[model samples]
Target: MSLLDFLRRRGSAPVARERLQVLLAYERANRGYSDLLAVLREEIVAVIARHITIDRDCVAIKMDRGDTVSTLEIDIEIPHKAGALLVGT
Candidate 1:
């Protein structure tokens, strides 16, 4: 393999590990809700897409269950327009 390819893979190992850890945690927490989560994510993305241009891959949804309450948390990353100044760097 080329040196560039080797370096690229080395650089991304940590990121891949982090993603895997998150997946494991989510799977453990959500258990049997995989199907429902997929559908819910799709629907939410569709609704949000009706108004703005967003990267679907940037959307994240997490559900937390408690004894008396369940909370659904959503995070959507809105892409900035070309030449737009961001408030926080």
Candidate 2:
């Protein structure tokens, strides 16, 4: 089965399980939580930039409390590549 099908079948998995593990690994590597946040933001922007043009100022990332744990939240503002304004007025 495809990855989506696997994920759908594993719908009982707790949210943020993977992200929490990542954050814990970052901490073990002597990286502060804030530092991890910055790295995550940059990586997310880079990944999204590969698919679309994005406004850097409109990019935001943070950790929020999930129903059972903390979850990483990513927000990106992508514009149409063709003649799209770089900034909103």
Candidate 3:
């Protein structure tokens, strides 16, 4: 059976040889993506900082992979201005 057929037949087909080959190639290229994500996260935080008050430590970005697709999720927590104003002098 073809690779695609094999994958369709079984969700996680036991293609260790093929899987390793693909993983090695992906890992080789993913270093750049990882670095880019880190830089992108910092840049995003910087941009958001210019507009609102946020907790940098709460900024989160993650990559999730599924059988057919992958996703990138970004989550940021912004502080409540009203609450802050209430506590201020």
Question: Highest TM-score among the candidates is held by which one?
Answer: 3
Q: Rank order by TM-score, top first?
A: 3, 1, 2
What tens-digit string does per-residue lDDT give for candidate 2 at 1-89? 99998988787455568778866775677645557778888888887777667787788887775556878878776666522645433
lDDT of 1 by residue, 1-89 (tens): 99999989888979999888876876798788768867999999999788767889999999786546779999988778611433544
TM-score: the better of candidates 1 and 2: 1
Instruction: Summing lDDT over every window of 10 consecutive residues in candidate 3, give the lowest-scoring window.
Output: 80-89
Best by lDDT: 1
Candidate 1 ranges beyond 4 A from true positions: 1-34, 82-89
Candidate 1: pairs in clash: none
Evaluation by lDDT, superior candidate among 1 and 3: 1
State candidate 2's TM-score. 0.48
Candidate 3: segments with Cα more than 4 A from true spot: 1-15, 82-89
Q: For residues 1-89, write the lDDT of model 3, one tens digit per residue.
A: 89998877786546777788877877887866768778989999999887777788989999876657879899987677834654774
Q: Assess candidate 2 and give its lDDT.
A: 0.71
How far residue 47's Cα lies from its native spot in candidate 2, in Å, is: 1.0
